[model samples]
Each structure stands twice: as structure tokens, then as C-alpha cells.
Target: MRSASAADFNATRFIARLRSRGLTWVLAIAVVLLQYPLWLGEGGWLRVREGAQKIDIQLALNQRLEVRNASLLAEINDLKQGRDAIEERARNDLGMVAPDEWFVRVVPAQSVQSGKTNE
Candidate 1:
């Protein structure tokens, strides 16, 4: 019975020591308070990294679109001012021919021959 009482006294003393400085409680509170903002906050490191990746993708897309837009604008301007540009666009896109020009489409014929057969 004395040994049990002594063990109880030791446990009570340890609890008293823990309650004195309250260091463990403070650490627990600090971790609990900081956990959400660290891992789940919008401005956290992971969110920042994701935002940066999105911005990079948008920047690349904008660059590609800008290049495409410049090409289209140049083509539009050329078509507006240059007769040769218009003619080239029409000849290529519209399959146009001048009055004296003939349109001929010649296609290569496919032949299935085995081994060393020759024509």
C-alpha cells in the first residue's frame, strides 16, 4: 500500500511540474494555430507554387497567342495593301487560276507487286 501511495505521489508531482511551465500546452497551441495556415491557407507555399505554375502556363499561352495574332495581323495588313499578297492567298487557299492557266491534278498510282517484279 505504501508503494502504491508513493507511485500516486510521483504521478501527482509530475503533473504539477507539467502544469508549472505550461510549455507543452504552449507548444500544442502553437502547432494547432499554425497548422491550418501552413498547409491549407491560400497564401501558403503550396498555393504560391500552384499559382506560379498557373501564371507560367497562362504566360506561355499568351505568348503563343501573341505570336499567332501578330502573324494574322501581318497577313491581314498584307492582304489589305498588297495585290500580290491577295493573289497569293487566293491562289493557295481558293485554288484559283488565271484565264490562260490550266489546272491539272496528277496523282501517283499505287501498285502492289511482290518480290522483284518490275514494269
Candidate 2:
């Protein structure tokens, strides 16, 4: 009968739709699995980028330390080569003076009113 053929046709269409949907879901899962290693694995882009950032930070620290070392070396050389630098440092830092001389300080009136003294 005509009603039986229509029922059969409807069942056929439903099966076809289910099969297509199954294939689509399988392909989607496959794509996700393939992308996992590229995005989250040990050799991924994020790890490489993180390593590059760490290298940059280390290089910057090394450069700053080199500059500091150079300045310290220069100071050491100056101290070793002459007594002038030592004498100046002693006079400024320790307030030292010659045995025959006196140490005098002159302060401004404004500093006195502000309650500030020489460090």
C-alpha cells in the first residue's frame, strides 16, 4: 500500500541522516586528536615561546651584571693606582681631616628652620 511505502521512505531518510551525523562526529574527533600534539605536547609552540622569554631574561641579567662588574673593576683599579681616591672617600664618608687642620660645616638658615642636618 501507499502508506506502507511512505513509512518505508521516512525510515530510510532517518537512517541516512544518522549515518551522516555519525561520520561528521568521527571526523571532528579525529581533527581534535591530531591537533593535540601541535598545541599541547612537549615540543609545542607555547614551550618554545616560554624558553625564548627565559633566555631573554637571562641575557638581560647577564648584561646588567657585566656592566656592574666593569664599574667595580674600575673602582678597584683606581684604589690600587693612587691614594687620591682613597683620601677623597675617607673625607666624604668618614668625615676625616688632616692632623693639623680643622673640620668646619656651614649650614643654610632654611635647612636649620626645616630641621634638616648634614647626613
Best by TM-score: 2
Worst 10 residues of 2 by lDDT: 37-46
Tens-place lDDT digits, model 2, residues 22-75: 999999999999988888889888888899999999999999999999999998
Candidate 2 matches the true fold with a TM-score of 0.73
Model 1 TM-score, 2 decimals: 0.72
Model 1 bad stretches (over 4 Å): 1-12, 20-22, 111-119
Candidate 2, residue 20: CA error in Å?
4.3
Looking at model 2, the pairs that clash are: none
Stretches > 4 Å off in candidate 2: 2-20
Tens digits of per-residue lDDT, candidate 1, 1-119, equal: 57988999999999999887698889899999898887779788789889999999999999999999999999999988979998898898898998999998654444333333233
